[model samples]
Target: MERKNHIILSILAILLAFSFQESRAESRDSLFFEWYTTTNMEPWKSTMEQMAAERTPDNYNQLFEVVLAWYGYIGYCLGNDKEEEAEQYLETGWKFLDELIEMNPTNAAPHALKSGFYGFEMALARYKALILGPRSVSTLKTAASIDSTNIHYLVEKGNQMYYMPSMLGGDKEIALHHYKHAVELMISDSRYHQRHWFYLNTLVTLGYSYQSTEHIKEARKTYQKIQRIAPNFKWFNEEVWPKFVEKYGTF
Candidate 1:
């Protein structure tokens, strides 16, 4: 009877622990959604700090936590023209990312993100562009080759193609193709993409890519699509759409 009781207790303990992890993951997702909708960086920074403090094992949810933290702070720093500050965060992010990659070398997500990190590093130090640029492409190509349907890989490749210098073969057409393909893939898997942080981001990316490529009608349609889904998304509604509508009007 005691042995049976012990086994039952062990099963209960395992379930409780799993529940806790799921709760934490849900909390992180809510916080991330807030950050995305509002563009308020406090929750983003706090989440990164919390993840750093936890130093948790790289389970799927926690791995996403690491990625969110890594991208949030470093992207914020770069956008705010704080390259020096971004370097410190980048180093920390790279450490965590590398550890995750080492532990799960077969995981395509980290490889895709690592490719973006290389781009971010180049952004921080353009002098190293010649060295890191091809690395960024190769890393992403490897990631995509591993999983051709990986939305993250597709999006990262689009970013690389769109942002790389024309001298280095940046083609807006390639960006459009990749972005459109990713969006299509995401829509095909609503369970996978619904409320996924990057779903909205990819749509925004596509909209901007269309604008830059002079696909004015497509750009306008993209904006309308986002508006339909998230009318209250502050970043898109207040900042992105308004600025876009200023030139294009309510289309």
Candidate 2:
């Protein structure tokens, strides 16, 4: 009877531990979602700091979330022209990404993220583009080859093609192809399109690509779709939409 009781207690203990972990995970997700909706960096920064401080092997996935959040924060800072703040986040983000890559060499996402960081660095220091540019492309290629279906890899590749000069083989048509493929892949998976910032950003990029190629009607329609899907996205609502209207008038 004592042996049976001990086994039951062990099972109960395991269940309780799992329940606690699940609760914590939910809390983290809630915090991240709040930050996402508000674009409030303080909450995200604090949450990431707490996660990093409490990190263990059991919470490696949470660490990845922190890294991805940091990447977004870096971009936010850069977009706001806060280069110093962006550089700070870039440094910390690189450390996390490097450790993650070391921990899982087979994971393509980290490689894609590192490639993006290099690209950001080049943007900050255009003089270094000659050196950092090739490295960025190489890392991205490695990531795509590792996981061709990864949405991040496809979006990054599309971004590279969209921004690169035409003389250097950047083709807006090819970029549109990549962006469309990425959208297709994301929409095919319900989990990917629902409240996913990356997917939304890809759509924005696709719209911009259309504008770059002088497809004003397509760009207007694309932006309109994004506004319908994510009306609260600040950049889309405040900046991109207003600029588009100013340039071409509302559709």
Candidate 3:
């Protein structure tokens, strides 16, 4: 009878542990989506810091989450014209990312992320572009060579092409092609389309590119697709859509 009771107690303990793990996973997912849709950085940043502090050797994904959250926070600061804050976050983010890269040099994602960070830094100081530009291009090329289909690498390449001056080989047509290829890659992976914030942002970039090129119909269709997928995206619903309507007369 004592042995039977012990076995039952062990089962209950196991069940409780499983339940706790499941709850934590759900909470993390919810927090990620909330941050993605609303750009509300504080809550997500707190959660990521907590997760990172608790990370074990087996918790690689948690570490990646922390890095990705930092990336998002940097973007948020830059978008709001907080250049100093953005640079601060960028430095901290690079500290973590550089460690990860050293640990796993062949992983393409970190390389892609580092490449993007260099580009962001260049944007903040165009004078530094002469030095940082080659670094950005080289890192991205390394990432692409390692994993040609990596969505992040593709997006960075597209962004470079989109923003570079025509004199420096920036072609809107080629940029569109890269963006389209990235979208197609994401579409083929349901997990990316459903949950990845970067995938959605890539779509937004593609839409704006279309608008810039005076492809109104395509731009409106892209925006409409974003609305259908994530109506809570404030930038699209509040800013882009209104400006688009004002300029192109409501699609």
RMSD of each: 2.5, 2.9, 3.6
Model 1 TM-score relative to the real fold: 0.87
Q: Give a tens-digit lDDT track for model 2, residues 88-195.
A: 878888888888888887878788888889988987899999999999999998998899777778778888888889999888888887887888898887435545
Stretches > 4 Å off in candidate 1:
1-9, 58-60, 188-192
Off by over 4 Å in 2: 1-37
| Candidates sorted by TM-score, best first | 1, 3, 2
Cα deviation of 186, candidate 2, in Å: 2.4
Better of 1 and 2 by TM-score: 1
Compute the lDDT of residue 112 as modeled in candidate 2.
82
TM-score of 3: 0.85
By summed lDDT, the worst window of 10 consecutive residues in model 3 runs over: 190-199
- Model 2 TM-score? 0.84
Model 1: number of backbone collisions: 0
Q: Report the Cα lDDT for candidate 2.
A: 0.80
lDDT per residue as tens, model 1, 120-187: 89888899988998898888878877896688798898998898778978999999999999999989
Clashes of 2: 0
Sum up the clashes in candidate 3.
0
